[model samples]
Target: MPLLPPWFHVRLTFGDGAVVDARAVVSEGRITIGDLSAGPPAPPDGHTAPADFAGPARHRARPSWPRGREGRRLVAEAYRAAQSEGRDPVLAVMRETGRSRRRSLRLVAAARDAGLLPPRHNRH
Candidate 1:
C-alpha cells in the first residue's frame, strides 16, 4: 500500500475578488492545491516520496499500532465478544479498527500469543 498525503480543504481569496476552493494534498514539503470542488481526493497515484522522508534522521517513528499488554488485552476482549456472539473474530477486529484484514488478523494473533486468549485446539 502507498503512503497517502494529508489533505486539507481550503478556500482561498485573492485580492482580485477571485475565490477558489481547493483541496490540498501535502506530501513531503510540497503541496498541490487546485480547484478541486469535485468529490474526495483520489488515492495517491504513484507519488514517490523521497527516501529521506522515510529515514529516522528527518522523521521520528510514530507508534501507530497499539502497544503493551493493555492493547493486547483489548484485542483479546474484542475477539472473545465476537466469538461469543458467533461472529467472525477477525471481522470484529477489522470493524473495530478499520484496518486491513491482514493487519487485523495479526492483531488477533498477537492477542492470542500474549496468552490473553485460550490456546486454539484442533477439534475434529
Candidate 2:
C-alpha cells in the first residue's frame, strides 16, 4: 500500500499562552479534519479549568442581585418558572442577572402574593 500527500498538521498558539493542535487531510476532492485540542493538552485522566473557573462563575462583572424594581422583575420571572414546574428554579437573577438568594426569595414571595402564582387550596 502507498500513502498520499495533501495531509497537514499545524500548531497554533495565542498570546494568552493558549495553544491548539490541528490535523487536516484533503484527498480526492474530499477533506477530513482531526480533533482540535485547545490550551495545554488535557491530562490522560480528564480535563480541568483553573481553580477560579472550576464551577459556576460568580464574577464581579455581574453583581449577584440587581437593585430595586429591576430586581423585583428578575425574581418574579424566576418565581414563575418555579411555580410552573411545581418547584423553585434558579432564575436568571440567581444564575445570570445576579441576585442574592435572600433577595430573590423575598421578591419571589412578593410576586407570589401579588398573584404571580395561582391561589393555593388547602387539601385534607
TM-score of each: 0.46, 0.39
Best by lDDT: 1
Give the residue spans of candidate 2 off by over 4 A.
Answer: 1-6, 40-63, 66-70, 73-106, 112-124
Tell me how candidate 2 scores on lDDT: 0.63
Candidate lDDT scores, in order, read 0.74, 0.63
Quick one: RMSD of model 2? 9.4
After TM-score superposition, the amount by which residue 94's alpha carbon in candidate 2 deviates from its true location, in angstroms, is 9.2
lDDT, residue 2, model 2: 82
For 7-123, candidate 2 gives per-residue lDDT tens digits of 688888776556888888888888677667666534344566456533666655755566566666666776567657877564543664555787555666665566664445656
Model 2: weakest 10-residue lDDT segment is 40-49
